[model samples]
Target: MTAGHCSDSGPFNSDGSVSFFHLPWGGIVGRRLIGPMARPDMSVADMGFISKRNPDIGVIPSIRNTDDQEFPELIIYGTLDSDTVGSTVCKSGYTTHVTCGEILAFGVTVTFLNGMEFNGLIKATHMSCGGDSGAPVFQFAEDILPGIFITGMVTGGSEEQGVCVIEPIAKLITDDIYVLTINDPI
Candidate 1:
């Protein structure tokens, strides 16, 4: 799941209609918004989905950490348990790119400037900025074939050091839907 603030604009046109998905490299990917799901109270989880199966834009389970090379593929086979704590984690996003840190706290509550309070969060030392709201937080180890797509960082704090608050993947799962993951084709 993502932070609710990321999709606050609704990804729609001024006429109140869904907008087409534009690829970063300038091409119509045929992706249509399925609508965003968020708490009216502007709580912790902010999630959305899109459908691009018609033209099959292709989904790559990878993240770009450096501008000098290709994206590093990550095989996501599972998720981190809610009780998981004191684990090393990493996140990749548009702003900060990629950062690694440790989980400092779990099942914590935080209040945003909008006066919205979110509970059951995973606080870490990872770095993130404004545009990094929806970036995936995961764990990668040497022997692990598929990393765990743990959560998404919603907010960042600590003026001197980079601290991020993440919405745990465990809390994002509902009866209707869950996050998607994939294994490397090799």
Candidate 2:
């Protein structure tokens, strides 16, 4: 899954029905576009999923530093549905790699420089910039489990420096979609 707008930017095929996602580790993953919600103001969670599957890559749930130098990739034990203000949240993006900050607000609506307005977002003090869209916003659950709980995907940055808006993962998930947790078979 990835930010819908991220697909909007695309390295699209001539038909525009598909996009190529580049990996920092070196490779390309072609994904079929599953169109995002159409809204006049974009108040909904800014996310979309790809229909294609990559069997070569491990499907185990995990999060790691982009470089895996500072911290190793760890399994995702499960998910957290609720978030509290002042709690720490971290994000890993194409541009920012990994950064953490406190949750400042919820149900935030943000307007990007492109004049695209996005709502139903979580506002955080994490440092972010362009190309960081579609990053994973997660919480470390070391106290309860030795893993992270993915909460949201980055929609974009806020006007305030060091702030970004995240679309809660819960809003993007559905009955047909299931996130792989530790309990799930790898």
Candidate 3:
């Protein structure tokens, strides 16, 4: 996928139906949404750009078949857990594109209809404000090209501590990683 920095500084739209600003790493190239999210109501308009400093947009499947069942790309984000106390995590959102903080120790495990369970942790602080639900998360890596593996979804952040919980990507999908196909892109 191609990407570029925000040319216009006004109202933003991330819905696939609408063309929004996506400044790729270092604002070198720009990309328009050629596909929609797995959920019809979701859109790239919901998420914003990845900062040049952070320099990663989660993960985009390197290869896959058209008939395969997987998401070509995945984004996940959430707030810090209140009980967590250690290394910090990063997040991108509409309000604040990049925010980082420690993870809280307390959280709840949610089970999906497929019997997949996600052990979500409350972030120690609010990395996201309003308009951040559905944001994406990435596991940071220094050498990897993508440098991140799309992990889960950001549900919400609390007002007091800014703790947000995440739904692990494994729990959301049937496969370990999304398989993408060039013949018929999703």
Write model 1 residue lDDT over 1-186, tens digit each, in one string.
345565456655565433334234222564444333432334435444433434434555554445425445565665666455677788876566667778888877877666667787888875654467767777774576434465554554554556778777776676775555664452
RMSD per model, one decimal: 4.6, 4.1, 12.7
Query: Which residue ranges in model 3 land beyond 4 Å of their true spot?
Result: 1-87, 106-124, 176-186
TM-score of each: 0.70, 0.79, 0.43
lDDT of 2 at 181: 85
lDDT of each: 0.59, 0.68, 0.41
Superposed by TM-score, candidate 2 places the C-alpha of residue 135 at a distance from the truth, in angstroms, of 1.3
Off by over 4 Å in 1: 9-44, 50-56, 65-71, 82-84, 145-148, 152-161, 183-186
lDDT of 3 by residue, 1-186 (tens): 111112123234463222433443234566533322222221222222322222343334332112224532322222122233564655555455555566655446534333434454334456664455555544444354323444445655566645666544443444533423222243
Q: Give the candidates in order of lDDT, highest first.
A: 2, 1, 3
Give lDDT tens digits, candidate 2, residues 1-186.
Answer: 777676665556566644433465322465333333321123465666654444454445776574665455756776676469988888877676777778889888777666777777788885664577877778888785447888887878755576877888788677987678888976
1 against 2, candidate with superior TM-score: 2
Against the true structure, candidate 3 has what lDDT? 0.41
